[model samples]
Target: MELKTIEELNQIGFEKIGEWKINKRGALDYEITTDKTTEVLYSFVKVDNQKEEIIYIGKTIRTIINRLNGYKKPGNSQFTNIRINKEILNLLKSDLNVNIYLFKCNDVITYKSHNINLAAGLEDTLIKYFKPKYNLHGNQRIIDDVELSENLIKLTNDMNDDKNCQNHYLIEKTTTVSNLEGKINLGNVPFSFLPEYGEIINIYLGDIVLQANFINGNNNGGNNPRINCVAIGNWLRENGINVNDNFYIKICNNNSFYFSINKIY
Candidate 1:
């Protein structure tokens, strides 16, 4: 069935549930409700003779249900509506149970730009932590290992070219770089550095080493760089890196490193 509004979703009921942070004002706001009004829930559908499987999970506050309804429009929605994708639709339709949950709030909330970012981050973190099958985007595994080795080598070679360069050493097992091969088609390298040291660095396809830089560090004074990390993660996921793997990172005064694949989501 097609979901139109928050009320409709509530009326249909749900089988599983989750929570979301909503901004009551223009700042970061939290709604604590014992009534499950603050959470988004899910339901499942059984395909063929298989058991029920969750298809969607979401929440709404105020009249924003109109936005959900608008998803029916072609090419305008962020998610591919099952109605339009016959393959996915059939898969869900054949499911025995479809789980869905709704979070409703009486008061309207206004979100600031930064607060939106925070909410997004919170949502992403929760989805990643939960590993919900319906949350496909959250299941991405960051490409580390080989990519990290390659970037470290490239960086080492680059720095080595400088005659005045001092000793450069990467923190053992702390350096991690994402491999980007298929996603990007054109321009330059896309790389993202996590400032907390040892976080996986995402490098995009077609990105060069010159574009990579630390997110919140000194950058050691050099030209800014950008690399594709999403592509790397996609490649790794396709190749066998599990999304739930335990990522370890290490950083030294001059270098960084990452090690091991612990899990896949």
Candidate 2:
């Protein structure tokens, strides 16, 4: 399980699935030739010229495309999804190419009349050996990459709360000067009523969508729930959203939400 380089992956039969990238508008772009519906153990590698670096390794029973979609449009509670999406977007913005490789375990072993998932079993071992920089050790620390901040690794346990995934919830808030400055306080809103801490939510202002991170105030006991969205601050300022402007967030049936400025203020 001492996987050191990308060459080891190809030598061990991992197939290159596709090259993934996001457009300027942050849309997913890739050409996948493998079966899109099968479970897989995959890796994300960045290719610069002839150099290759494995950034992540993960196994998913939900197929490659579905998992990629999750990374592309992460939910409010999906810290890893949000983190990886940001990493991918930043790298793409710098013109780095990320490629994906998939491995399907056809060699099955049965134990006690139950089929063993080789892909699942091998994931940890490979991660331990390869130690992809983005892979976290039980949400505590990055496996190989130590540069990530400790606070970032300490995200909420309920990372991807997708319950009632199809229901649209309305979250209304009035814009304050503080909100327009990027720190939005969910005044008097119960913690249980909003997305969990460390969640990344998509807020729409007209046709534009801004991704924001939900967090607690100076005290971490959900004392004051707030959202951190620098983009929203710029958008609000640019669009004449001032103090006392009313805005409402409409959580969509999908993994996104939209907001409208009731009063342009």
Candidate 3:
């Protein structure tokens, strides 16, 4: 059987008394076909952030539409068999592409009572086939939306390796930097672990990214030289982070003494 679209399902009536679906929204928005309604409910179905993976699959027996609609809300956390985080739900409704592929049968099966068995089989078949992330019975391949670069992963692993890093100290703190006249006062940071001047570092302000250069200054007042990088200061301003916005810094590993700066919020 082929999965038919909403328009196609309307044109070609179902011959079997089993389940039918009209694609509504998200990755897989399906419902037990009924006499009324065109098709689809965003609930009882969800797609991952990238819309490349189907995250959840569900079935409703009586009052299928109501059951499907219940998934839209986070009630007493009792409606859904699997946990659906608020963030995940928001992503599903926002970015997930909805489509329905009706697997209509040849033989006609009309009434809802008879369609129960058929719906069960169809739901099970889809759950097993897709192995949706939210499914508890089928292929429980749960994967989140966190994306990590290979180099970042390796750097973190290296930081945690005792053999490579002996008595390594990790500092994760929120700090605000000073940018005055294209000069950045890095403050009382452990600059001993940092590389020489002219090297590059990364700075992220929300979605905006920037590459910053480290230029040495004269330490005439018994303090370490401040970094004079105009590009980063300008980039921060461009990204709506002025000279004193709180930025979160994460050092994947001091093995390279490289730290990545991220915008808070």
Superposing all C-alpha atoms, what RMSD in Å does each candidate have to the true structure?
Answer: 18.3, 13.3, 23.1
lDDT by residue (tens digit), candidate 1, 86-124: 333344444332322433333333354221222222333
Q: How do these models rank on TM-score, best leading?
A: 2, 3, 1
Which runs in model 2 stand beyond 4 Å of their true positions? 138-265
Q: How well does candidate 3 score on lDDT at residue 9?
A: 31
Better candidate number, 1 or 2, judged by TM-score: 2
Q: Kindly indicate the candidate among 2 and 3 with the higher TM-score.
A: 2
User: Which is the better candidate, 1 or 3, if ranked by lDDT?
Assistant: 3
Let me know the TM-score candidate 1 reaches against the reference structure. Answer: 0.27
Task: lDDT for model 1, please.
Answer: 0.30
TM-score per model over all chains: 0.27, 0.53, 0.30
Best by lDDT: 2
Best by TM-score: 2
Clashing pairs counted in every model: 52, 3, 9
